[model samples]
Target chain A: MAEIVSLADAVAELVRDGDVVALEGFTHLIPVAAGHEIIRQRRRDLTLVRMTPDIVYDQLIGAGCARKLIFSWGGNPGVGSLHRFRDAVQNGWPEPLEIEEHSHAGMANRYVAGASGLPFAVLRGYTGTDLASVTSTIKQITCPFTGERLAAVPAINADVSIIHAQRADRAGNVQLWGLVGVQKEAVLAAKRSLVTVEEVVDELEPVDGGIVLPSWAVTRVAEVPGGAHPSYAQGYSERDNGYYAEWDPISRDRAEFEKWLERTRTTGVPA
Target chain B: MSTATTELTYTSDEMMSIAAARALSAGQRCFVGIGLPSTAANVARRSHAPDLVLIYESGALGAKPDRLPASIGDGILAETADAVVSVPEVFNYWLQPGRIDVGFLGAAQLDKFGNINTTVIGDDYANPVVRLPGAGGAPEIAASCHEVYVIVRQSKRSFVDRVDFVTSFGHGRGNGDRARLGLPGAGPTLVITDLGVYRPDEHTSELTLTALHPGVTVEQVREATGWQLRVADELARTPAPTSDELAVLRALKEAS
Candidate 1:
């Protein structure tokens, strides 16, 4: 069974320095609050993993909590470039961060392989691209059946996985819907899992196409409404598109980013 | 010198978007990349290709949005989608099986043979001059979709002779490259830019300027390109955006 705990306690217990942590959400239901808590706790040297490293990852990188990022895409969605991510890669301000990049298909397959308890996953990908050259995780394998060549990538089993969801019953069985991207696999693929939810209900009513993670599968659950602020929860809240647009300028300059970081530390929530 | 005057009501970007939108046929399943390609695909659905199935990597399949989605995973996409699956399924079942018909994409850098680079601007991957958002779904989308279309603004900086990195494979060197690599899908066949439309040569696989938007000169296109751009022997003039197209595009933009 899962433990119902406060956000701080969950982060303190589950995450540690130099642990491989994955905060996976494609666009909807991103665990921004947990990411903020990690920043507030000043965790260091962690390898942060996600498919698309949006604003939360940007904040984590800017806060100097991550030593490496394993991700596919790193942009601000409809908005332009992630200035802080650019700064780190180009200048190495707070630290010289390392990156292991892949296409979305490759990253998704890795998670699937991890969830399935497989050593690696095979796909018809990265044949003519330079990604295979740069990423050592990608290698060529021959099919025993047809003698076909294919790309194989290692499974990504994280030390801990964190995500945000719509709701969970008091028993800690989590349910989420609407563009449920890679969260289920991510949680299952980790040694431990933390889920932050909008509310804790008595029962999880059957939702169409909703994914349910049984209590035994999860490690911890915390009630944090609006946890995915700049992103969103489908029925709980709307995505604050304005904030995403506003973030571009705030994250551009080092001094401005530092001021924002200071504000986040004082307010107990990211500004 | 001869003087010619044409109505300058719509912007070049508007022309580019309309041209790109017209390329999509009704009932084609398009795997859309965000940004300019998203705008064009939406415009196509709202205007001509109403049955055009819009698939987002965020797992919204056949998404029919009233407004432009701010991001691929915008609630509007899921709320209006025919079905929603997980990201893994979107790539594995729907895309890798060659179910999608078209892959519409945008690029940070493009080469003459249509290879895309959204990974890094500089040659050094570890320390890049500009670290673009690395490949999202473009690599497989470029590989698995039956056909691929690219839309980007044309400039000397973006339209380079050789992209710094090959984030998505189009044609490796020239003819028979994709075949030699055993890639299933036909790589980038059409490229739509802010200036004009380019089609890959049937034999050489080099992008050749097939048509130019109204009021744009061949000289202007050449000045903006990095390579020795090839112009079609009989370059056709792209029709200016009709009043209807302008109205629909403007309304869509305003609504978003």
Candidate 2:
């Protein structure tokens, strides 16, 4: 039987300094509450890894928690500003960082292959493109049968994996119908696992007659209904599309983050 | 409709022209990209492709985005989307299975053969400058889509004799070679720019302008290109953008 932890307590316990943590949700599907807790806790010198990046990474970088970030796409949603990330990439930041960009499959298959304990996963996605060299951590191989050359990407490993889900049972069976890529991989890759969920069901209540992610992989579950607000999970209200419509007020410039930290609520503004 | 006009009426030709060129068929499954391609795609979705299956590289399928996304990582693409699958399943299942009818793109650099370079702006790989977006699924979409459409602003700097690097895959080594690579389907079928609509000649891979936008001339188009430009004998006039089309597109941008 796993003990239920509060959202803040669960996150603070999982994340540590100098650890690589992968967050769940693509772009903005899931909220960045878990990482936000660490930022509030003022954890420093953290290395981050992701397949694709968005505003949350910018927030993490802005909060001065992230030492390095690894991912493919990096930019503010539409506001065209992310002061935290800009400081690290365009300007120099306190931490040393390296960026590994590749196609979605090139990054993902590598994790799948890694979790399976394979040396490298073959993919035809990155041939002749700069992704092969930029993410040189990924290699190329020749098909013994077809004589075709393909991409061989290495697996991703992290110290802790923090993910937010639409719903979870007390047993930690997870459910997320939309954009749950590598959630399992991030869980398997991390040594310590933590989950942020909307609500806790009694037991085995089928979302669509099935489970999205199971209990064995889930170590911690924190129930926070309406927590993923502003970041829609479908069937929940529509995303706080307006929040992103305007450039995140916090990410406008270098000093903007000072305002960002003040405005954003850790437990979501006492709602 | 009053003739007095309004402040919102854009007098400049550039914004209107960009708007008109991006109008696409509604309800198409577009394998969308970032930057100009994303702009054009969102415009298309707002203007005409309302039911468009806007597939972002992040694996959001049929995304009903309320605003124009600045990048692929916008939550609007996923949270508001109809369905979101794993990174692998989105590409391997939806895209490679031929659900994507059109792949929309733009380029930093191009050659006569239609190859694109979004990787670097300099000459060498190991030590060149201007490391670009580094190809995020553009290659697969370019190689496998039933048809690919490109929208780029014509400029000498962009239309190069040879690409500085390969970002999105197209016309792999010229006519018929992409087919040889078992790339699954026809390569880039259309290159749409502010100047005109260009297609790679069936025999030679040279880009030949077929339709020039109204008020655009062959010389003006050439001035914009980096390569020695060519035009078809019968250059068709691109249709002008209607007021309604411009209205929807501008509103869409405002929302984004």
Candidate 3:
């Protein structure tokens, strides 16, 4: 059974130091509130996983919460560079961050493998490319039937997987629509999972393209409206484009990033 | 209407966009990336390719976003999409299995053979002067889509002899390299640039200038290319965007 808790409590209870945590959302439902809570609680040494690490991951990396980033793409989307991410890699400002890069296909397959309880997943990728040499996780395997060479990557089983969705019923049945991404796979792959949603309703009315995770699959549920602000919830909000544009300058300098983080610390959310 | 040769109100960017958009036909399944590529695909969708099956990296299938989405994950895409599935399903079922007809993208750097680089700016990977948003689904989309169309602003710097990194395999080293590597799709078929349109030479796999955009000279194209620019024996002047194309593109921007 899943326990209904506050965002702070969920973060405090599930996330720990040196744990592999995945906050899975493609571009929508990014779980910004949960990331802020992790920063507020001062968790450290987390190996953060996501396909595209946007502003929330930037905030986590800026706050010195992440020791490593396992991702395919990291950017500010339409904006330029992630200065803090560059700082950690170049100067080791707060701490030296390690990167385990993979293609989006490889990362998605890793989650799929994890969800399926398989050791690894096979795909036709990284052929005549350089990713295989750089990423240690990527290996080569042959098909038994056709003797075709394929790329294989180990499963990504995390300690805790967190996601922000549109809504959930009181019984902890989470429902998310729009751009679903790998939230379901990440939840099924993780040993423990937390879902923060915009609302807790009495009934889980079906959405057109919704995926409902049964209460048994989730560990905790927290009601955090506007949880995916800066990103977005399908029915609840629009992507805060202004914030993304505003974040470029804030995340450019170490001092600016710190100032922003301090401000967030004071308010308990990014303005 | 004052017949002053249809005043050139649109910039070269819009010209390139319209040129790229025209390449896509109705009902083609397009695997689109963000930025200029998305803009081109949407322009096509609004203008002629109304039934274009727009598949985004975020797993929005048949997305008919009325407005331009800020990102691939923008809720507008999902809201307008016919269906949304998990990320794994997107790559596994739609993209990897080669179901898509066209792969649309933009590149930070491109080589003569049509190989693209979107990873880094400098030679050194460890300490790059500029680190770009690494490959999301480009590697697979390039590999599996039936054909690819690249839209980029042409310059000596962007059109290089060799890309700093190979983010997506094109013709590899040209000739039979792609086939030898077992890449399913025909690598980049067309590269639409601010200067002109380039198509791969069937024999050499090198991008050759087949058509020049309005008011753009072959000399300008040659000057912008890093390598020896190849021009077709009888180059075709790419017709300027029809008023209808411009009208639709302008309306799209205004509506979005």
lDDT of each: 0.94, 0.68, 0.89
TM-score for each predicted model, relative to the true structure: 0.98, 0.80, 0.97
TM-score of chain B of each: 0.97, 0.88, 0.96
**lDDT tens string, model 1, B1-256?**
4244556498999999999999999999999998889999999999999999999999999999988888989999999999999999999999999999999999989999999999999889888888999999999999999999999999999999999999999998888999999999999999999899999999999999999999999999999999999999999899889878888888889999
Q: Give residue B59's error in model 1 in angstroms.
A: 0.2
lDDT of 3 by residue, B127-197 (tens): 77777778888888889999999999999989998898888888888889999988999989999999899
Model 2, position B234: C-alpha lDDT score: 82
Across A1-271, the per-residue lDDT of candidate 1 in tens digits comes to 9999999999999999999999998899999999999999999999999999999888999999999999999999888888888888899978878999999999999999999999999998988999999999999999999999999999999999999999999999999999999999999999999999999999999999899999999999999999989899999999999999999998898899999999898899677
Q: Rank all candidate structures by their DockQ, best first, as comma-separated numbers.
A: 1, 3, 2
**Candidate 3 residue-wise lDDT at B21:** 94
Q: Which ranges in model 1 have alpha carbons more than 4 Å from their true place? A: B1-8
Backbone clashes, each candidate: 0, 0, 0
Clashing pairs in 3: none
User: By TM-score, who's the top model here?
Assistant: 1
Which residue pairs show collisions in model 2? none
Tens digits of per-residue lDDT, candidate 2, B1-256, equal: 5564543444324443454336557767888876667766777776655676788877678887777775565656766777766776777777766778888877778777788876557876534455454455677787667888877777888887778877766776677767666676576778877677888888876788888876778998888887777788888887556677677667767886
Model 2 DockQ (Cα-based)? 0.40
